[model samples]
Target: MSTTSLGASAPSRAGADGTGAATGPLRARRRWSGARLAPYLFVLPALALFAAFRLYPIGWSFVLSLYHTDGMAQTWAGLDNYQRLVDDPLFWKALGNTALILVVQVPVMLALALGLSVALNSALLRWKPVFRLGFFLPVVTGLVTYGLLMGALLNQDSGAVNWLLQLVGLPEVHWLGEPFWARISIVLALTWHYTGYNAVIYLARLQGIPAEHYEAAAVDGAGPWRRFWHVTLPGLRPALVLTVVLSTIGTLQLFDEPFIMTGGGPDNATTTIGVYLYQTGFRYFDFGYASAIGYALVLIIAVFGIVQVKFAKEED
Candidate 1:
């Protein structure tokens, strides 16, 4: 009877140990799965949509670039379209025009934005919210509306811009009819339209900076310019990088203003890569060529983006 009881107790003890071990693993697995999988559950929908829309289109366009057709039915032409792009002077010209805007307009616009942002950050400024709203309102305006408004303002004979020039004793000039003037006009219009936007971004960054820094600078007898260079500018580095990168990309892919106002014209002087792509794909019905241009834009933007990332990281 003693031996029988001991054997039964031994079996019960073994079974309890095994059950505890099993439960421990189950609990650990539940905790591990929850921690690892929770973030992905939140991100999955957005990731799915981005892949479905953006990534898929880019991949599809590249594949389409290898063929010749209106996308109705493509016949494989290999790399012929890309090869043709090498010798296409129009492509180079469009590229040069886009580069000019990137080189010139982006700096001018961002500088103005930074200045305006600094001014708005001043406590001396009255009605700060009103001023900010006034600046940002143009950015939210409909693109088509701005385009039409610009066209009216730049109209050669009676446009507000030319009329103002005439009133100032300057000869009435062809704002959009001439190549150099057309480029300048477009740049000015884009700058006017986007400056407020960049200012708003900079202002947000400026607000986040601790007020103690400025107070300390003042106590040290540092003037505004010195304070800006030492404190404000360092604080603005991130905002500057953001503005430069976004503005560079925006100018590189410039389309609407030129398309609506100059129609890429006065002899294709204002044609940008984006506008050129539109003309080739939609206007001339060359989907393959258009896809090639689109891919080229991706390459250009990638290079600039890489440079910006490097600069930002170096700053950090």
Candidate 2:
């Protein structure tokens, strides 16, 4: 009887140990799942903020574009606003002005920036830090301040630019008064403000280029221009593409300079798509039309972005 009782008690103890061994892995798996979730939990706040601010506003803007609102009553307008935009001569003029800037200003600014980056990166250049700071200063300055300064400097009569022109036996230019001059002034201001920023980008890319490539080119009897064309140009292609796309987008959304400097005036010669959108929305109180213009601008940006990407891929 005693031996039988001992055998039954040993079996019961073995069963209890087996049950604990099985539960141990289950608890560990639960802990591991919680640990794996920590990173996503940490990112939740930023995701929420982005959704609230950026994504929500974009969605609401699209919805608003489909409805006509007069700050009082609202009605569904569907594509009427878009049709109005097509017929609106001012919209076309604005688009033309923006295209002109994109074609003329972007290339000039980027070329100048590339040149400045090369100069700054050269070993022969002195006071490199000072040059960089001086060039970058304009980028850090407030847009409104820069606009006011530009306006004062380019004033028709007492402005410093005209004063210097007269001193040099040249006629005073109507920098802000005439249509052609107004457009030119806008381009000049944009170039001055953004050139340094683009140069910094190019400078960073320049620094990353391998010195061995240039040395090898020098050994092969390649002149400076040939080396640049073969080695440097290939290296800078990615940066060039990036800057071009950015400049295109910026040129399409040009508003601050034209608004502050010319008020889209001088016969609307400097009016851009962004300026037109603002005018339609606030000045004319055509919210739906403005939203439509905004979407059109977005569409233009998307199409250009896609084309740029495709071109880059082909080049690659």
Candidate 3:
């Protein structure tokens, strides 16, 4: 009887809920499974929130683009909204303005950023951390505050910039009040705002480039320009492509700087597709058209991205 008692197994475990169920190995496995799933359980709420907020809204916007809505009471309109975009004069104007900025501003900004990155990455540079910090500090500045400051500085009258020009005997140009100068103002603001950000990206890429390549280039009697053209440019190809595509998208959707700087004014001279879309939806309460505009911008960005990737691949 003692031997049999010794051989008898322990009683079933009560779960954490205190209801005795499976015993021994099975109970251990159930607990193990729950432990394995515990992390996912903890993460489930955040995933749910993301789906509810970001994913659901994105899906709904696409659906909403198919209907006409005055902020409410959406009615099925099929492709009519898209068709309307084709004929909208203001849409064309906004698109043209965006394209102009993309063409002019992207190259200039990227070129400046690339040069800055190279300078920063140079071993001969002194106080590298201080320079880097100063360049990057602008990125952390609040958008509205920066915009207001720039607007005040670039003001046609009684502004520091104009005052300096007058002091130097240069005629004061209407930076925000004229179409041509307004666009220039916008480009300057964008370049100032994002050059450091792009430079940081390029700097990371630059750091990853092997020193052996530069040494080899120098050993082959390559001068600074030749080395930069061959080794540096080639090493920076991926970064260049990334920044180009991103800058293109950003310029196409240009809004914040122009909005705060010019109010898309001097007669909508600085109005971008983003600003136009906002005006259409919020100001006019044409929700469907605005949704259509948003999707059109998305489509344009996708096309540009694909083209850029294809070009990069070809270069590869």
Most lDDT-accurate candidate: 2
Which tens-of-lDDT digit does each residue in 66-162 have in candidate 2? 8898886779999988888889999999999999988999999999999999999999999999999999999999999999889888999889999
Task: Score candidate 2 by TM-score against the native.
Answer: 0.92
Each candidate's lDDT (Cα)? 0.92, 0.93, 0.91
lDDT of 1 by residue, 157-240 (tens): 889888899889998879899999999988988998999999999999999999999999999999989999999999988988
Candidate 1 lDDT (Cα, 0 to 1) = 0.92
The 10-residue segment with the lowest total lDDT in model 2: 65-74
**241-292, model 3: which lDDT tens digit per residue?**
9899888878888888988999888888899999999988889998888989
RMSD of each: 3.7, 2.5, 4.6
Q: Which ten residues in a row have the lowest lDDT in candidate 3?
A: 9-18
TM-score of each: 0.85, 0.92, 0.89
Per-candidate clashes, comma-separated = 0, 0, 0
lDDT of 3 at 31: 93
Superposition error at 294 for model 1 (Å): 0.6
TM-score of 1: 0.85
Best model number under TM-score: 2
What's the distance in Å from true for residue 310, model 1?
0.3
